[model samples]
Target chain A: MACGRPKLRVGPSQREGGFTDSVPATVSRMENQSMRITALIVCLPLCAFGAATAQGLLLQRAGSQAENRPVIPKASKGDQCVADTEIMRKDHMSLLNHQRDETVIEGIRSEPYSLVSCVNCHAQTDTSGQAIRIDAEGQFCESCHSYAAVKIDCFTCHAAKPAAMEVIGNAEPHLMRDNPHTLVSYLLNKEANE
Target chain B: MSRVPVADNEKSLQARRRFLQGLGLAGMASMSYSLLEVKAKTPASSDKRWGLLIETEKCSSGCDACVRGCNEEHGIDDAGDDLTRAQWIRKIDLKDELTGNETSLPVMCQHCESAPCVDVCPTGASFKRADGVVLVNKHTCIGCRYCMMACPYKARSFIHETLTEQKPSAPRGKGTVESCTLCVHRIDEEQDRQPACAVKCTEEAHSAITFGDLNDPDSSISQKLNTLGGSQIRADLQLNTGVRYQGL
Candidate 1:
């Protein structure tokens, strides 16, 4: 007098034959949950490891190709720079921003850090010997900025190329001379000879 | 042989003494030169307040040499039509109300002591340098034309179109208000060099504009202003402009 179906009686030998009639329902449920937990624990680390290894390989492959990396131009003044390459590569924007304030606001137009000075040194020329614009592709500023996915708007208001000639009638006559440091050197040498 | 060594020692001692003396002299000279340089360059403490004295009597009725010079200096010759043109300086003709005679004079940013344009700028992009030269910092200018509206003389202009081939000394661009900077680049580089307009005027033999320090009594412009009593364009505003006009 079962509710729906009549229960068929099986021998005790058939208990391990994938029949859960003798096993407690609670024990079976717990076993299923434990199996799921074990699967997740085993699979999670394996998936993560796989993803990380794949990413590492991709990065290594990209790194091996020069085209994937940013091309920094050789400095006109050999390896001399206002700052160390590592520091400049990381924090150049901040330094330039601070320098802009100093030059524009305070009127401190010192060399090697000024925008004009940077253009004088870093501005590159094509085969025709004309200076390239700052925002041109493959140019010194654009190449690095584009590779880093940064947008630079400095060339919009600033001259992208170095001035062909220095502005006329500089206040310091010595500075205008062909050999600017000659006077200082001469003085030093005269002192040495004396 | 012993006497020869003695002589050599004496000679070396004399050379060392002379070297020390020369070093002392050079140090003194450099120290003095540096002191002079500081006095000359320091805008705050300097007794030289730069100004322009424009003798309207000498200004020709139709000549625009000053304006042309300014245009060439700033590379604004190609600035498009009348409305969008960057007019650093302009020649304006005025008819006398009583005399029925027409006179012309060059007008530009007066470089006021208490500039309203500087006051109204939200970002302080419009600023007066320590030398009293009013200039716009294009880096901070947000294309807000508050300075243009605030100017009493209508001296400022907003660049509407993109600029190209700008002079290296004058870095102007689109979306920024600009006005006469009194050739600040030249002033910074050369104390003796006049503003382009003044130079052009002299070259043309008009000699209408004279540029010199107002603070120094010995300066030619100061002497002329003191004796001739020049007038500011908007004297009612009490702006105390650096540029002054005579025979207006």
Candidate 2:
């Protein structure tokens, strides 16, 4: 009745008949049962050792491929970030959220935790010195975010590059419309169309 | 032309006269007289209500400089069809049916003190700032369009398509209702405060729009409003809109 099935108590003679093929027929029933228990104990460690070795090999392979990890770009502006690197890595979302509320809701724009500042410092440049967007493929934000499988929603509305970055052949004045957001792409497409 | 008759009552006139007299004394003393001296990097305070006064008589009907300036400023002209494109500011032509007189003015968000948009927003996205700038917090906005329905002036526009090349200062995207921010970014950033439309209007030589703190009696907008008189669109609603029109 233990486990919803009738637990029939097998006698030593019944066990002896059941184990006759596996255990030697001349061996005593007590000795046979003890040897079976010994075998079970020995198999457990062997299975665990095999699994441990497999895990160790995986760890070694991963460690050797360290260069495959996300490459964080150096900040172009300040010597250091507004916060420590480790702190920024962990708490940048909360910091940006706090600053967003202050700037957007309260109309306080001077704080250093702004997304614009992050782009100004972190955005990279191309061969001809045109600023590359931080969220573009293999770029600053994308490197880590794509590796971590985290989707960035900020650049959907916010510019991914600094506003002052110059795009080649754009004759427009450096006004708000000339910001390096879609304007660069828009002008480039227009140039292509022409 | 209809006049709003603001501060026209005997008691209000007496209070305004006393304020002007005090301002005159303060100005004569050369103490850099200002009700609220705004500093850099600070949140806008309730003490100063930012507003605009558009002289309709001066606003030229054919000119779309203000509209163009506003669109360029916010990066709203890049995409979307004419039917769905967001218009933060628009030039409206008004004609007096009986007298055959015509008036032209730029219309945008009125930034009402008791904003219907602020009232109807289910997610509290439409809110009035401390300085009385009604704004839509797109982060909280669910694109319900309830605020658009409630608004009397038809100020707000719903962004329909995915936007690109958004300005760093004005971050607009699809699935959120937006309106004229009254150039809140310029007011916050630049030392010389003027919305893009106002700046463009001035650049175009119309100089029809005047932006200043309505609470400051010494401010040009309030002073001009006090003397020349101004009227709000749909004044019967009593929203007490921050944007006013003169010679309407």
DockQ values of all predictions: 0.12, 0.24
Q: Write the per-residue lDDT of candidate 2 for residues B97-144, one digit (tens) a residue.
A: 999999988889999877878766777778877788999988889999
Summarize candidate 2's per-residue lDDT along A10-48 as a digit string, tens digits.
888777775556656688979879999999999999999
Q: Considering summed lDDT, which 10 consecutive residues are worst modelled in model 2 chain A? A: A171-180
Question: Model 1 off-target regions past 4 Å?
Answer: A1-67, A77-79, A165-194, B1-47
| Chain A TM-scores in order | 0.57, 0.62
State the lDDT of candidate 1 residue by residue for B1-248, as single tens digits. Answer: 23443344335534644564464356447533222222212222234567899999999888999998898788886445988878888789999789898879998999987677877778767876656677898898998999889888989888988877776678899999999988877766545778989988998999999998888898999899889899999898877899999998
Deviation (Å) of B208 in candidate 1: 1.8
Per-model TM against the reference: 0.73, 0.76
For model 2 the local lDDT of residue A152 reads 94
lDDT by residue (tens digit), candidate 1, A57-143 = 999898886667878787543345566777668856765775465456545443234566566567788898777776688878888
Q: What is each predicted model's overall lDDT from 0 to 1? A: 0.73, 0.78
